[model samples]
Target: MIEHKPLRLLRHLAWIPAIWIAWELLHYEQYKLLGNPGSVFLFTVLTDWLGFHGYEKAMRLGVGAMEIAASILVLIPRTQGFGGLFAMGVMSGAIFFHTVSPLGIDPYSDGGVLFKEACLTWAAGLLVAVLRRDQLVALFNRIAGRDAAVPA
Candidate 1:
């Protein structure tokens, strides 16, 4: 297992660049494969969800900074847990927005995009959860130890 650690790290690290590239591609409209309407809807949803409705300029800078920080933390072994937590928070907000806005799946309509986003968010959260499992286990163990030491 130890021998494969490097490969595993590489795979995880690759997601960062891939995500960045995809973001850039979308931002520049270099790839319209997803359709303009869908892209516009997604951007509007993101901006609104992020509380940048009337603050587009600030959000433009803030979002990039936040994303870079999150990506950097995620790639750093010592800070991966923190990064994962941040990612989970952002993704959860996204999922909530989609679910609450009537933008999600519909049996008779083309609402599958929301479903796809939700699934992706879950997958990302799961990745972080798995990455931080050891820390979680250790925290629980510490709490259990403290309880065991109590006189009651």
Candidate 2:
């Protein structure tokens, strides 16, 4: 019952991006949820620029909730692919806002730390998605009512 070495290595490697995405999402949850100054500022600028001034709180809370969900999903072995997809979606919005809104690359003026993190997390999520593509395909098959079995 010996597994091929490359397969074993790949299985182990999949956890790296999953853990990195989850850690970043969870670490920032408090700031987003608790109205930390930086988080509030970022959201404010985004909402203002997007003409959603009155909905800043809603947008912030919604993004925070999604991040929490993504973190939870990414940490679970069975749902890692979905989590990666979710993380990528969320980070995509963040990256888009950072680039398009008044919130430029260096929003906090800290040399674009937040912007860089979003980009890195987006890339990591892509890796997770690629690594767990089998699960993603299976999920798609189930949703589409297609046969899930693979030919031997």
Against the hidden reference, what TM-scores do the models get?
Answer: 0.48, 0.91
Rate residue 109 of model 2 by lDDT. Answer: 76
User: Clash totals for all models, in order?
Assistant: 0, 0
Q: What are the C-alpha RMSDs, in order, of all predicted structures?
A: 8.8, 2.7
Off by over 4 Å in 2: 1-5, 149-152
Clash count for candidate 1 is: 0
**Model 1 whole-model lDDT (C-alpha atoms):** 0.51
The number of the candidate with the highest TM-score is 2
lDDT of 1 by residue, 1-152 (tens): 15368646644654554354234323433212333455455555557766668554454445445555665555555555455555556556546756666444432267665456545644664566465555445545657884322110
Cα deviation of 90 in candidate 2 (Å)?
Answer: 0.6
Per-model lDDT:
0.51, 0.86
- The model with the greatest lDDT is 2
Candidate 1 clashing pairs, residues 3+ apart or interchain? none
